[model samples]
Target: MLRQSSRFVVNRASAALVGRGRRFSTDLPAETGGDSKFVDDWKKVIPNLEPPKTPSAYMKPRPQTPSTIPSKLTVNLVLPYDSALSAKEVDMVIVPASTGQMGVLPGHVATIAELKPGVLSVHEGNDVTKYFLSGGFAFVHANSITDIVAIEATPLDQIDIASVQKGLTEFQQKLNSASTDLEKAQAQIGVDVHSALNAALTG
Candidate 1:
Protein backbone atom coordinates (compact mmCIF):
# COMPACT_ATOMS: atom_id res chain seq x y z
CA MET A 1 0.00 0.00 0.00
CA LEU A 2 2.81 2.42 0.87
CA ARG A 3 4.71 1.70 -2.38
CA GLN A 4 1.56 2.30 -4.45
CA SER A 5 0.85 5.70 -2.85
CA SER A 6 4.48 6.87 -3.42
CA ARG A 7 4.28 5.84 -7.09
CA PHE A 8 1.00 7.73 -7.58
CA VAL A 9 2.51 10.96 -6.13
CA VAL A 10 5.52 10.69 -8.45
CA ASN A 11 3.25 10.33 -11.49
CA ARG A 12 1.21 13.43 -10.53
CA ALA A 13 4.40 15.59 -10.06
CA SER A 14 5.75 14.52 -13.48
CA ALA A 15 2.42 15.45 -15.14
CA ALA A 16 2.38 18.87 -13.40
CA LEU A 17 5.93 19.66 -14.53
CA VAL A 18 5.05 18.79 -18.19
CA GLY A 19 1.97 21.02 -18.08
CA ARG A 20 3.99 23.95 -16.61
CA GLY A 21 6.63 23.66 -19.33
CA ARG A 22 3.96 23.73 -22.06
CA ARG A 23 2.27 26.81 -20.52
CA PHE A 24 5.60 28.73 -20.39
CA SER A 25 6.45 27.79 -23.99
CA THR A 26 3.07 29.08 -25.24
CA ASP A 27 3.39 32.36 -23.31
CA LEU A 28 6.70 33.15 -25.03
CA PRO A 29 6.49 34.74 -28.48
CA ALA A 30 8.33 33.20 -31.41
CA GLU A 31 11.63 34.91 -32.35
CA THR A 32 11.02 35.44 -36.07
CA GLY A 33 13.57 38.30 -36.61
CA GLY A 34 12.98 38.89 -40.35
CA ASP A 35 12.57 35.33 -41.60
CA SER A 36 9.99 32.85 -40.26
CA LYS A 37 11.18 30.38 -37.66
CA PHE A 38 8.02 28.30 -38.23
CA VAL A 39 9.03 27.87 -41.87
CA ASP A 40 11.99 25.73 -40.87
CA ASP A 41 9.96 23.77 -38.32
CA TRP A 42 7.21 23.06 -40.86
CA LYS A 43 9.76 21.87 -43.41
CA LYS A 44 11.16 19.40 -40.90
CA VAL A 45 7.67 18.00 -40.14
CA ILE A 46 6.30 18.10 -43.69
CA PRO A 47 9.20 18.17 -46.15
CA ASN A 48 6.95 18.26 -49.24
CA LEU A 49 4.71 21.16 -48.09
CA GLU A 50 5.56 24.73 -49.09
CA PRO A 51 5.64 27.57 -46.56
CA PRO A 52 3.04 30.35 -46.87
CA LYS A 53 4.20 33.66 -48.31
CA THR A 54 4.47 36.66 -45.94
CA PRO A 55 3.28 40.22 -46.74
CA SER A 56 6.90 41.36 -47.22
CA ALA A 57 7.39 38.73 -49.88
CA TYR A 58 4.58 40.17 -52.08
CA MET A 59 5.31 43.88 -51.47
CA LYS A 60 7.79 45.75 -53.66
CA PRO A 61 11.08 46.70 -52.00
CA ARG A 62 11.28 50.37 -51.05
CA PRO A 63 13.73 52.54 -52.95
CA GLN A 64 17.00 53.56 -51.31
CA THR A 65 17.07 57.03 -49.72
CA PRO A 66 18.66 59.65 -51.95
CA SER A 67 21.59 61.73 -50.71
CA THR A 68 19.94 64.98 -51.87
CA ILE A 69 16.28 65.98 -52.23
CA PRO A 70 14.90 66.60 -55.72
CA SER A 71 14.10 70.11 -57.01
CA LYS A 72 10.52 69.54 -58.13
CA LEU A 73 7.75 67.88 -56.15
CA THR A 74 5.92 65.12 -57.99
CA VAL A 75 2.16 65.49 -57.51
CA ASN A 76 -0.67 63.10 -58.36
CA LEU A 77 -4.21 64.37 -58.06
CA VAL A 78 -7.08 61.99 -58.72
CA LEU A 79 -10.84 61.88 -58.51
CA PRO A 80 -13.12 58.89 -58.22
CA TYR A 81 -13.74 58.64 -61.96
CA ASP A 82 -10.70 60.43 -63.35
CA SER A 83 -7.05 61.15 -62.77
CA ALA A 84 -6.90 64.94 -62.50
CA LEU A 85 -3.09 65.01 -62.49
CA SER A 86 -0.47 62.29 -62.67
CA ALA A 87 3.25 62.46 -62.08
CA LYS A 88 3.19 66.22 -62.54
CA GLU A 89 6.18 68.07 -61.13
CA VAL A 90 5.37 71.35 -59.45
CA ASP A 91 7.07 73.96 -57.26
CA MET A 92 4.44 73.90 -54.53
CA VAL A 93 0.88 72.94 -53.63
CA ILE A 94 -1.51 74.46 -51.06
CA VAL A 95 -4.03 71.98 -49.64
CA PRO A 96 -7.07 72.72 -47.47
CA ALA A 97 -6.55 70.41 -44.51
CA SER A 98 -9.07 70.03 -41.70
CA THR A 99 -6.65 71.83 -39.37
CA GLY A 100 -6.05 74.66 -41.86
CA GLN A 101 -4.51 75.45 -45.23
CA MET A 102 -1.19 73.61 -45.58
CA GLY A 103 1.53 74.51 -48.11
CA VAL A 104 3.67 71.63 -49.35
CA LEU A 105 6.99 71.85 -51.18
CA PRO A 106 9.76 69.57 -52.20
CA GLY A 107 11.38 67.77 -49.20
CA HIS A 108 8.24 68.30 -47.14
CA VAL A 109 8.00 65.88 -44.22
CA ALA A 110 5.95 62.72 -44.74
CA THR A 111 2.38 63.38 -43.67
CA ILE A 112 -1.25 62.42 -44.21
CA ALA A 113 -3.68 65.31 -43.96
CA GLU A 114 -7.47 65.12 -43.93
CA LEU A 115 -8.83 67.62 -46.46
CA LYS A 116 -11.88 69.79 -45.91
CA PRO A 117 -14.17 71.78 -48.19
CA GLY A 118 -11.98 74.56 -49.55
CA VAL A 119 -9.70 75.61 -52.35
CA LEU A 120 -6.64 73.64 -53.45
CA SER A 121 -3.93 75.55 -55.26
CA VAL A 122 -1.01 74.21 -57.27
CA HIS A 123 1.86 76.57 -57.94
CA GLU A 124 4.33 76.45 -60.77
CA GLY A 125 6.51 79.52 -61.20
CA ASN A 126 4.22 82.58 -61.21
CA ASP A 127 1.23 80.62 -62.49
CA VAL A 128 -1.21 79.09 -60.01
CA THR A 129 -4.20 76.85 -60.66
CA LYS A 130 -6.96 76.71 -58.06
CA TYR A 131 -9.75 74.19 -57.57
CA PHE A 132 -12.58 73.79 -55.09
CA LEU A 133 -12.54 70.39 -53.43
CA SER A 134 -15.54 68.98 -51.57
CA GLY A 135 -13.49 66.63 -49.38
CA GLY A 136 -10.61 64.17 -49.57
CA PHE A 137 -7.16 63.36 -48.26
CA ALA A 138 -3.58 64.35 -49.07
CA PHE A 139 -0.64 61.99 -48.82
CA VAL A 140 2.86 63.41 -48.67
CA HIS A 141 5.63 60.87 -49.07
CA ALA A 142 9.22 61.24 -47.98
CA ASN A 143 10.42 60.81 -51.59
CA SER A 144 9.02 64.21 -52.62
CA ILE A 145 5.78 62.76 -53.91
CA THR A 146 2.39 64.26 -53.04
CA ASP A 147 -0.96 62.65 -53.80
CA ILE A 148 -4.30 64.43 -53.52
CA VAL A 149 -7.51 62.48 -53.76
CA ALA A 150 -10.92 64.08 -53.71
CA ILE A 151 -14.52 62.95 -54.00
CA GLU A 152 -15.48 66.04 -56.02
CA ALA A 153 -13.28 68.77 -57.50
CA THR A 154 -14.15 71.74 -59.74
CA PRO A 155 -12.13 74.58 -61.19
CA LEU A 156 -12.50 77.75 -59.18
CA ASP A 157 -13.48 79.80 -62.18
CA GLN A 158 -16.14 77.33 -63.33
CA ILE A 159 -18.42 77.58 -60.27
CA ASP A 160 -21.50 79.71 -60.84
CA ILE A 161 -22.11 82.27 -58.06
CA ALA A 162 -25.89 82.37 -58.56
CA SER A 163 -26.28 78.60 -58.22
CA VAL A 164 -24.14 78.45 -55.06
CA GLN A 165 -26.14 81.23 -53.43
CA LYS A 166 -29.46 79.56 -54.27
CA GLY A 167 -28.26 76.25 -52.81
CA LEU A 168 -27.04 77.96 -49.65
CA THR A 169 -30.40 79.68 -49.09
CA GLU A 170 -32.37 76.49 -49.79
CA PHE A 171 -30.25 74.47 -47.34
CA GLN A 172 -30.54 77.14 -44.69
CA GLN A 173 -34.33 76.97 -44.84
CA LYS A 174 -34.24 73.18 -44.69
CA LEU A 175 -31.99 73.27 -41.65
CA ASN A 176 -34.39 75.63 -39.79
CA SER A 177 -37.45 73.49 -40.67
CA ALA A 178 -35.75 70.10 -40.06
CA SER A 179 -37.76 67.94 -37.58
CA THR A 180 -35.79 64.67 -37.50
CA ASP A 181 -32.15 64.24 -36.51
CA LEU A 182 -31.23 62.78 -39.89
CA GLU A 183 -32.87 65.64 -41.78
CA LYS A 184 -31.08 68.19 -39.61
CA ALA A 185 -27.73 66.46 -40.21
CA GLN A 186 -28.23 66.34 -43.97
CA ALA A 187 -29.31 69.98 -44.12
CA GLN A 188 -26.34 70.99 -41.99
CA ILE A 189 -23.90 69.26 -44.36
CA GLY A 190 -25.44 71.00 -47.34
CA VAL A 191 -25.24 74.36 -45.66
CA ASP A 192 -21.64 73.87 -44.66
CA VAL A 193 -20.58 72.77 -48.13
CA HIS A 194 -22.38 75.61 -49.88
CA SER A 195 -21.02 78.14 -47.40
CA ALA A 196 -17.50 76.86 -48.03
CA LEU A 197 -18.10 77.13 -51.76
CA ASN A 198 -19.30 80.73 -51.46
CA ALA A 199 -16.38 81.61 -49.23
CA ALA A 200 -13.90 80.06 -51.65
CA LEU A 201 -15.28 82.03 -54.57
CA THR A 202 -15.53 85.37 -52.75
CA GLY A 203 -12.38 85.13 -50.60
Candidate 2:
Protein backbone atom coordinates (compact mmCIF):
# COMPACT_ATOMS: atom_id res chain seq x y z
CA MET A 1 0.00 0.00 0.00
CA LEU A 2 2.82 2.55 0.77
CA ARG A 3 4.71 1.74 -2.44
CA GLN A 4 1.52 2.24 -4.56
CA SER A 5 0.83 5.56 -2.82
CA SER A 6 4.39 6.82 -3.57
CA ARG A 7 4.14 5.70 -7.19
CA PHE A 8 0.88 7.71 -7.70
CA VAL A 9 2.43 10.91 -6.19
CA VAL A 10 5.46 10.60 -8.53
CA ASN A 11 3.23 10.26 -11.61
CA ARG A 12 1.23 13.41 -10.69
CA ALA A 13 4.47 15.38 -10.25
CA SER A 14 5.73 14.19 -13.63
CA ALA A 15 2.48 15.23 -15.40
CA ALA A 16 2.62 18.78 -13.87
CA LEU A 17 6.25 19.18 -15.01
CA VAL A 18 5.40 18.09 -18.58
CA GLY A 19 2.46 20.54 -18.84
CA ARG A 20 4.75 23.48 -17.70
CA GLY A 21 7.36 22.51 -20.29
CA ARG A 22 4.76 22.42 -23.12
CA ARG A 23 3.43 25.95 -22.18
CA PHE A 24 6.99 27.42 -22.18
CA SER A 25 7.81 25.77 -25.60
CA THR A 26 4.66 27.21 -27.22
CA ASP A 27 6.02 30.81 -26.61
CA LEU A 28 9.29 30.01 -28.46
CA PRO A 29 9.97 31.51 -32.02
CA ALA A 30 9.64 28.22 -33.92
CA GLU A 31 6.36 27.42 -32.12
CA THR A 32 4.89 30.98 -32.61
CA GLY A 33 6.16 31.06 -36.27
CA GLY A 34 6.96 34.87 -36.07
CA ASP A 35 9.78 37.16 -34.65
CA SER A 36 8.13 39.39 -32.00
CA LYS A 37 11.55 40.96 -31.12
CA PHE A 38 12.11 41.99 -34.75
CA VAL A 39 8.58 43.50 -35.02
CA ASP A 40 9.17 45.51 -31.80
CA ASP A 41 12.53 46.83 -33.09
CA TRP A 42 10.91 47.96 -36.37
CA LYS A 43 8.14 49.81 -34.46
CA LYS A 44 10.77 51.67 -32.41
CA VAL A 45 12.81 52.58 -35.50
CA ILE A 46 9.80 53.81 -37.64
CA PRO A 47 6.49 54.51 -35.84
CA ASN A 48 4.88 55.79 -39.11
CA LEU A 49 6.37 56.00 -42.64
CA GLU A 50 5.78 58.53 -45.50
CA PRO A 51 6.82 58.54 -49.20
CA PRO A 52 9.90 60.66 -50.14
CA LYS A 53 9.71 63.66 -52.59
CA THR A 54 11.79 66.75 -53.62
CA PRO A 55 10.59 70.32 -52.67
CA SER A 56 9.73 72.92 -55.46
CA ALA A 57 10.11 76.72 -55.70
CA TYR A 58 6.99 78.94 -55.61
CA MET A 59 6.39 81.57 -58.43
CA LYS A 60 3.90 84.47 -58.97
CA PRO A 61 2.76 86.39 -62.10
CA ARG A 62 3.65 90.10 -62.53
CA PRO A 63 1.34 93.11 -63.12
CA GLN A 64 1.32 95.18 -66.35
CA THR A 65 1.90 98.96 -66.83
CA PRO A 66 0.02 101.49 -69.03
CA SER A 67 1.26 103.39 -72.14
CA THR A 68 1.65 107.16 -72.77
CA ILE A 69 0.32 109.80 -75.24
CA PRO A 70 2.14 111.28 -78.29
CA SER A 71 3.41 114.90 -78.63
CA LYS A 72 4.10 116.17 -82.19
CA LEU A 73 2.39 116.32 -85.62
CA THR A 74 3.79 117.33 -89.06
CA VAL A 75 1.71 118.11 -92.15
CA ASN A 76 1.81 119.90 -95.56
CA LEU A 77 -0.54 122.56 -96.96
CA VAL A 78 -1.09 122.84 -100.75
CA LEU A 79 -3.06 125.40 -102.75
CA PRO A 80 -3.92 125.86 -106.40
CA TYR A 81 -1.60 128.24 -108.32
CA ASP A 82 0.28 129.09 -105.12
CA SER A 83 3.16 127.80 -103.04
CA ALA A 84 2.40 125.09 -100.51
CA LEU A 85 2.54 126.14 -96.89
CA SER A 86 4.46 123.80 -94.59
CA ALA A 87 2.94 123.53 -91.11
CA LYS A 88 3.35 121.52 -87.95
CA GLU A 89 0.80 118.89 -87.06
CA VAL A 90 -1.93 120.82 -85.30
CA ASP A 91 -5.30 120.45 -83.56
CA MET A 92 -7.59 121.72 -86.29
CA VAL A 93 -7.67 123.25 -89.82
CA ILE A 94 -10.94 124.94 -90.85
CA VAL A 95 -11.73 125.33 -94.55
CA PRO A 96 -14.51 127.21 -96.36
CA ALA A 97 -16.10 124.87 -98.90
CA SER A 98 -18.81 125.82 -101.39
CA THR A 99 -21.24 123.70 -99.39
CA GLY A 100 -20.17 125.12 -96.02
CA GLN A 101 -17.34 125.19 -93.47
CA MET A 102 -15.29 122.05 -92.81
CA GLY A 103 -13.07 121.29 -89.80
CA VAL A 104 -10.20 118.79 -90.05
CA LEU A 105 -7.73 117.35 -87.56
CA PRO A 106 -4.94 114.80 -87.31
CA GLY A 107 -5.71 111.16 -88.26
CA HIS A 108 -8.74 112.39 -90.20
CA VAL A 109 -10.04 110.13 -92.96
CA ALA A 110 -9.30 111.04 -96.60
CA THR A 111 -11.91 113.25 -98.22
CA ILE A 112 -12.55 115.57 -101.20
CA ALA A 113 -14.88 118.55 -100.86
CA GLU A 114 -15.85 121.89 -102.54
CA LEU A 115 -15.35 125.23 -100.78
CA LYS A 116 -17.39 128.45 -100.70
CA PRO A 117 -16.59 132.07 -99.96
CA GLY A 118 -15.70 132.32 -96.25
CA VAL A 119 -12.87 132.35 -93.72
CA LEU A 120 -10.57 129.41 -93.12
CA SER A 121 -9.21 129.31 -89.57
CA VAL A 122 -6.09 127.30 -88.86
CA HIS A 123 -5.40 126.51 -85.24
CA GLU A 124 -1.85 125.63 -84.20
CA GLY A 125 0.03 125.65 -80.94
CA ASN A 126 -1.42 128.61 -79.00
CA ASP A 127 -2.19 130.53 -82.20
CA VAL A 128 -5.23 130.89 -84.50
CA THR A 129 -5.17 132.67 -87.86
CA LYS A 130 -7.73 133.15 -90.63
CA TYR A 131 -7.51 133.10 -94.45
CA PHE A 132 -10.34 134.17 -96.78
CA LEU A 133 -11.29 131.80 -99.56
CA SER A 134 -13.65 132.74 -102.43
CA GLY A 135 -14.09 129.32 -104.04
CA GLY A 136 -12.06 126.12 -103.78
CA PHE A 137 -11.87 122.35 -103.45
CA ALA A 138 -9.93 120.48 -100.76
CA PHE A 139 -8.28 117.06 -100.85
CA VAL A 140 -7.27 115.47 -97.52
CA HIS A 141 -4.76 112.62 -97.42
CA ALA A 142 -3.65 110.09 -94.86
CA ASN A 143 -0.70 112.19 -93.66
CA SER A 144 -3.06 115.13 -92.93
CA ILE A 145 -1.88 117.13 -95.94
CA THR A 146 -4.77 119.30 -97.17
CA ASP A 147 -4.53 120.40 -100.77
CA ILE A 148 -6.74 123.46 -101.32
CA VAL A 149 -7.34 124.37 -104.96
CA ALA A 150 -8.92 127.81 -104.73
CA ILE A 151 -10.43 130.26 -107.19
CA GLU A 152 -9.31 133.02 -104.82
CA ALA A 153 -7.77 133.19 -101.35
CA THR A 154 -6.95 136.56 -99.83
CA PRO A 155 -5.27 137.21 -96.54
CA LEU A 156 -7.06 139.78 -94.39
CA ASP A 157 -3.98 142.01 -94.02
CA GLN A 158 -3.35 141.93 -97.77
CA ILE A 159 -6.89 143.08 -98.80
CA ASP A 160 -7.30 146.69 -100.05
CA ILE A 161 -10.18 148.45 -98.16
CA ALA A 162 -10.22 151.48 -100.43
CA SER A 163 -10.59 149.42 -103.60
CA VAL A 164 -13.52 147.48 -102.08
CA GLN A 165 -15.31 150.72 -101.12
CA LYS A 166 -14.76 152.22 -104.55
CA GLY A 167 -16.17 149.11 -106.19
CA LEU A 168 -19.24 149.31 -103.96
CA THR A 169 -19.92 152.94 -105.01
CA GLU A 170 -19.63 152.05 -108.73
CA PHE A 171 -22.06 149.15 -108.43
CA GLN A 172 -24.58 151.32 -106.53
CA GLN A 173 -24.46 153.93 -109.29
CA LYS A 174 -25.06 151.26 -111.94
CA LEU A 175 -28.14 149.99 -110.02
CA ASN A 176 -29.58 153.55 -109.75
CA SER A 177 -29.11 154.23 -113.53
CA ALA A 178 -30.74 150.97 -114.77
CA SER A 179 -33.47 151.69 -117.40
CA THR A 180 -34.97 148.19 -117.87
CA ASP A 181 -35.85 145.11 -115.75
CA LEU A 182 -33.02 143.04 -117.23
CA GLU A 183 -30.52 145.84 -116.64
CA LYS A 184 -31.76 146.31 -113.12
CA ALA A 185 -31.35 142.63 -112.35
CA GLN A 186 -27.77 142.63 -113.70
CA ALA A 187 -26.93 145.77 -111.72
CA GLN A 188 -28.50 144.28 -108.60
CA ILE A 189 -26.19 141.19 -108.83
CA GLY A 190 -23.19 143.51 -109.20
CA VAL A 191 -24.27 145.43 -106.13
CA ASP A 192 -24.59 142.22 -104.10
CA VAL A 193 -21.13 141.07 -105.20
CA HIS A 194 -19.53 144.42 -104.34
CA SER A 195 -21.33 144.55 -101.01
CA ALA A 196 -20.08 141.07 -100.05
CA LEU A 197 -16.52 142.04 -101.07
CA ASN A 198 -16.74 145.24 -99.01
CA ALA A 199 -17.95 143.35 -95.96
CA ALA A 200 -15.17 140.75 -96.32
CA LEU A 201 -12.52 143.46 -96.61
CA THR A 202 -13.79 145.42 -93.62
CA GLY A 203 -14.31 142.32 -91.52
Candidate 3:
Protein backbone atom coordinates (compact mmCIF):
# COMPACT_ATOMS: atom_id res chain seq x y z
CA MET A 1 0.00 0.00 0.00
CA LEU A 2 2.81 2.44 0.95
CA ARG A 3 4.77 1.69 -2.23
CA GLN A 4 1.70 2.17 -4.43
CA SER A 5 0.78 5.43 -2.72
CA SER A 6 4.31 6.79 -3.19
CA ARG A 7 4.34 5.74 -6.86
CA PHE A 8 0.97 7.38 -7.49
CA VAL A 9 2.09 10.69 -5.98
CA VAL A 10 5.32 10.72 -8.00
CA ASN A 11 3.48 9.83 -11.21
CA ARG A 12 0.90 12.59 -10.68
CA ALA A 13 3.63 15.14 -9.96
CA SER A 14 5.64 14.09 -13.05
CA ALA A 15 2.49 14.17 -15.21
CA ALA A 16 1.70 17.66 -13.99
CA LEU A 17 5.22 18.83 -14.83
CA VAL A 18 5.06 17.20 -18.27
CA GLY A 19 1.62 18.69 -18.90
CA ARG A 20 2.96 22.11 -18.03
CA GLY A 21 5.66 21.56 -20.71
CA ARG A 22 8.42 22.01 -18.17
CA ARG A 23 11.17 19.47 -18.58
CA PHE A 24 13.82 19.62 -15.90
CA SER A 25 16.82 17.38 -15.45
CA THR A 26 17.79 16.57 -11.92
CA ASP A 27 21.45 16.23 -12.99
CA LEU A 28 22.03 19.95 -13.01
CA PRO A 29 21.30 22.60 -10.42
CA ALA A 30 18.60 25.13 -11.25
CA GLU A 31 20.80 28.23 -11.43
CA THR A 32 24.22 27.06 -12.58
CA GLY A 33 26.79 29.62 -13.74
CA GLY A 34 30.41 29.99 -14.68
CA ASP A 35 33.05 30.53 -12.01
CA SER A 36 35.18 33.68 -11.77
CA LYS A 37 38.36 31.95 -10.69
CA PHE A 38 41.81 33.12 -11.80
CA VAL A 39 44.20 30.31 -12.56
CA ASP A 40 47.96 30.99 -12.94
CA ASP A 41 49.26 27.48 -13.56
CA TRP A 42 50.91 28.51 -16.86
CA LYS A 43 53.25 30.99 -15.13
CA LYS A 44 56.87 29.82 -15.10
CA VAL A 45 58.58 30.18 -11.75
CA ILE A 46 62.06 29.08 -12.87
CA PRO A 47 64.51 31.69 -14.16
CA ASN A 48 66.19 31.03 -17.52
CA LEU A 49 69.97 30.93 -17.57
CA GLU A 50 71.79 33.47 -19.72
CA PRO A 51 73.20 32.10 -23.00
CA PRO A 52 76.93 32.09 -23.95
CA LYS A 53 78.40 35.20 -25.58
CA THR A 54 77.50 35.66 -29.26
CA PRO A 55 80.14 38.27 -30.18
CA SER A 56 79.36 41.92 -31.22
CA ALA A 57 75.67 42.10 -32.15
CA TYR A 58 73.94 39.55 -29.89
CA MET A 59 76.24 39.97 -26.88
CA LYS A 60 76.39 43.74 -26.94
CA PRO A 61 73.81 45.65 -24.83
CA ARG A 62 71.33 46.65 -27.52
CA PRO A 63 70.35 50.30 -27.83
CA GLN A 64 66.85 51.22 -26.64
CA THR A 65 64.42 51.01 -29.54
CA PRO A 66 61.99 53.85 -30.08
CA SER A 67 59.39 51.42 -31.50
CA THR A 68 59.32 49.31 -28.36
CA ILE A 69 55.88 48.52 -27.01
CA PRO A 70 54.87 50.00 -23.68
CA SER A 71 53.84 47.94 -20.72
CA LYS A 72 50.19 48.21 -19.74
CA LEU A 73 48.34 47.21 -16.62
CA THR A 74 45.47 44.85 -17.46
CA VAL A 75 42.70 44.73 -14.93
CA ASN A 76 40.10 41.93 -14.87
CA LEU A 77 37.40 42.74 -12.39
CA VAL A 78 34.76 40.02 -11.98
CA LEU A 79 31.56 39.53 -10.06
CA PRO A 80 29.84 36.27 -9.12
CA TYR A 81 27.42 36.19 -12.05
CA ASP A 82 29.49 37.89 -14.76
CA SER A 83 32.63 39.84 -15.49
CA ALA A 84 32.50 43.57 -14.89
CA LEU A 85 35.85 44.22 -16.52
CA SER A 86 37.96 41.98 -18.75
CA ALA A 87 41.59 42.48 -19.72
CA LYS A 88 41.02 46.23 -19.77
CA GLU A 89 44.02 48.54 -19.70
CA VAL A 90 43.91 50.86 -16.73
CA ASP A 91 46.41 53.39 -15.46
CA MET A 92 45.78 52.82 -11.75
CA VAL A 93 43.63 50.85 -9.30
CA ILE A 94 42.97 51.94 -5.75
CA VAL A 95 41.87 48.92 -3.71
CA PRO A 96 40.41 48.95 -0.25
CA ALA A 97 42.74 46.30 1.12
CA SER A 98 42.35 44.66 4.48
CA THR A 99 45.73 45.89 5.59
CA GLY A 100 45.11 49.40 4.30
CA GLN A 101 44.21 51.27 1.14
CA MET A 102 46.71 50.37 -1.59
CA GLY A 103 47.33 51.74 -5.06
CA VAL A 104 48.35 49.52 -7.97
CA LEU A 105 50.03 50.58 -11.19
CA PRO A 106 52.10 49.04 -13.89
CA GLY A 107 55.12 47.12 -12.49
CA HIS A 108 53.47 46.94 -9.10
CA VAL A 109 54.69 44.15 -6.81
CA ALA A 110 53.14 40.75 -7.42
CA THR A 111 51.05 40.18 -4.30
CA ILE A 112 47.59 39.19 -3.13
CA ALA A 113 45.39 41.51 -1.17
CA GLU A 114 42.19 40.73 0.72
CA LEU A 115 39.69 43.42 -0.14
CA LYS A 116 37.12 44.92 2.20
CA PRO A 117 33.75 46.56 1.69
CA GLY A 118 34.63 49.89 0.12
CA VAL A 119 35.01 51.78 -3.12
CA LEU A 120 37.46 50.51 -5.71
CA SER A 121 38.72 53.37 -7.83
CA VAL A 122 39.86 52.44 -11.31
CA HIS A 123 41.66 55.14 -13.23
CA GLU A 124 42.06 55.25 -16.98
CA GLY A 125 43.93 58.33 -18.09
CA ASN A 126 41.89 61.28 -16.82
CA ASP A 127 38.65 59.37 -16.12
CA VAL A 128 38.13 57.43 -12.91
CA THR A 129 35.37 54.88 -12.29
CA LYS A 130 34.55 54.01 -8.71
CA TYR A 131 32.89 50.69 -7.82
CA PHE A 132 31.64 49.81 -4.38
CA LEU A 133 32.67 46.25 -3.52
CA SER A 134 31.45 44.08 -0.70
CA GLY A 135 34.54 41.86 -0.43
CA GLY A 136 36.86 39.66 -2.53
CA PHE A 137 40.48 38.94 -3.47
CA ALA A 138 42.91 40.84 -5.66
CA PHE A 139 45.74 38.93 -7.33
CA VAL A 140 48.49 41.01 -8.89
CA HIS A 141 50.70 39.22 -11.38
CA ALA A 142 54.28 40.06 -12.30
CA ASN A 143 53.23 40.64 -15.92
CA SER A 144 51.08 43.67 -15.04
CA ILE A 145 47.78 41.80 -14.85
CA THR A 146 45.57 42.20 -11.79
CA ASP A 147 42.53 39.93 -11.27
CA ILE A 148 39.87 41.08 -8.87
CA VAL A 149 37.10 38.66 -7.84
CA ALA A 150 34.58 40.55 -5.78
CA ILE A 151 31.58 39.11 -3.97
CA GLU A 152 29.40 42.09 -4.82
CA ALA A 153 30.21 45.23 -6.81
CA THR A 154 28.08 48.21 -7.77
CA PRO A 155 28.27 51.92 -8.29
CA LEU A 156 27.06 54.25 -5.55
CA ASP A 157 24.59 55.91 -7.88
CA GLN A 158 22.81 52.60 -8.58
CA ILE A 159 22.36 51.86 -4.88
CA ASP A 160 19.40 53.62 -3.29
CA ILE A 161 20.43 55.43 -0.10
CA ALA A 162 17.00 54.91 1.43
CA SER A 163 17.23 51.12 1.05
CA VAL A 164 20.69 51.06 2.57
CA GLN A 165 19.51 53.14 5.50
CA LYS A 166 16.59 50.81 6.12
CA GLY A 167 18.83 47.76 6.09
CA LEU A 168 21.33 49.44 8.39
CA THR A 169 18.64 50.36 10.87
CA GLU A 170 17.20 46.85 10.81
CA PHE A 171 20.61 45.25 11.28
CA GLN A 172 21.37 47.59 14.14
CA GLN A 173 18.16 46.53 15.84
CA LYS A 174 18.99 42.88 15.20
CA LEU A 175 22.43 43.36 16.73
CA ASN A 176 20.99 45.00 19.82
CA SER A 177 18.27 42.39 20.30
CA ALA A 178 20.48 39.37 19.56
CA SER A 179 20.86 36.97 22.47
CA THR A 180 23.58 34.73 21.00
CA ASP A 181 27.14 35.64 20.06
CA LEU A 182 26.86 34.31 16.48
CA GLU A 183 23.65 36.20 15.77
CA LYS A 184 25.20 39.42 17.04
CA ALA A 185 28.28 38.91 14.87
CA GLN A 186 26.22 38.28 11.74
CA ALA A 187 24.04 41.30 12.42
CA GLN A 188 27.13 43.37 13.09
CA ILE A 189 28.55 42.47 9.68
CA GLY A 190 25.32 43.57 7.98
CA VAL A 191 25.37 46.82 9.94
CA ASP A 192 29.01 47.42 9.00
CA VAL A 193 28.40 46.93 5.26
CA HIS A 194 25.33 49.14 5.26
CA SER A 195 27.28 51.74 7.22
CA ALA A 196 30.07 51.62 4.65
CA LEU A 197 27.60 52.05 1.78
CA ASN A 198 26.05 55.00 3.58
CA ALA A 199 29.46 56.57 4.00
CA ALA A 200 30.37 55.98 0.36
CA LEU A 201 27.15 57.64 -0.74
CA THR A 202 27.18 60.52 1.75
CA GLY A 203 30.85 61.27 1.26
Q: What ranges in model 1 sit over 4 Å off?
A: 1-65
Give the 10-residue window scoring lowest on summed lDDT in candidate 1.
22-31
Name the runs in model 2 displaced over 4 angstroms: 1-81, 172-196, 201-203
* Highest-lDDT candidate: 1
In candidate 3 the C-alpha lDDT for residue 161 amounts to: 91
Give me the overall lDDT of model 3: 0.73
Model 3, 1-203: lDDT tens per residue?
Answer: 45554464465457657845532121122232111010111112212322222122222222222243336678989998989999899898999899878999877766889998998999998988999999899987655678899989997679999999999999999999999999999999999899989988898
> Which tens-of-lDDT digit does each residue in 75-141 have in candidate 1?
9899999998998999999999999999999888778899999999999999999999999999887
Model 2 vs. true fold: TM: 0.49
Best-to-worst ranking by TM-score: 1, 3, 2
Candidate 3 — which residues are off by over 4 angstroms? 1-71
Winning model by TM-score? 1
lDDT of 3 at 191: 92
- State the weakest 10-residue window (summed lDDT) of model 3: 33-42
Cα displacement (angstroms), candidate 3, residue 181, comes to 1.8
Candidate lDDT scores, in order, read 0.80, 0.58, 0.73
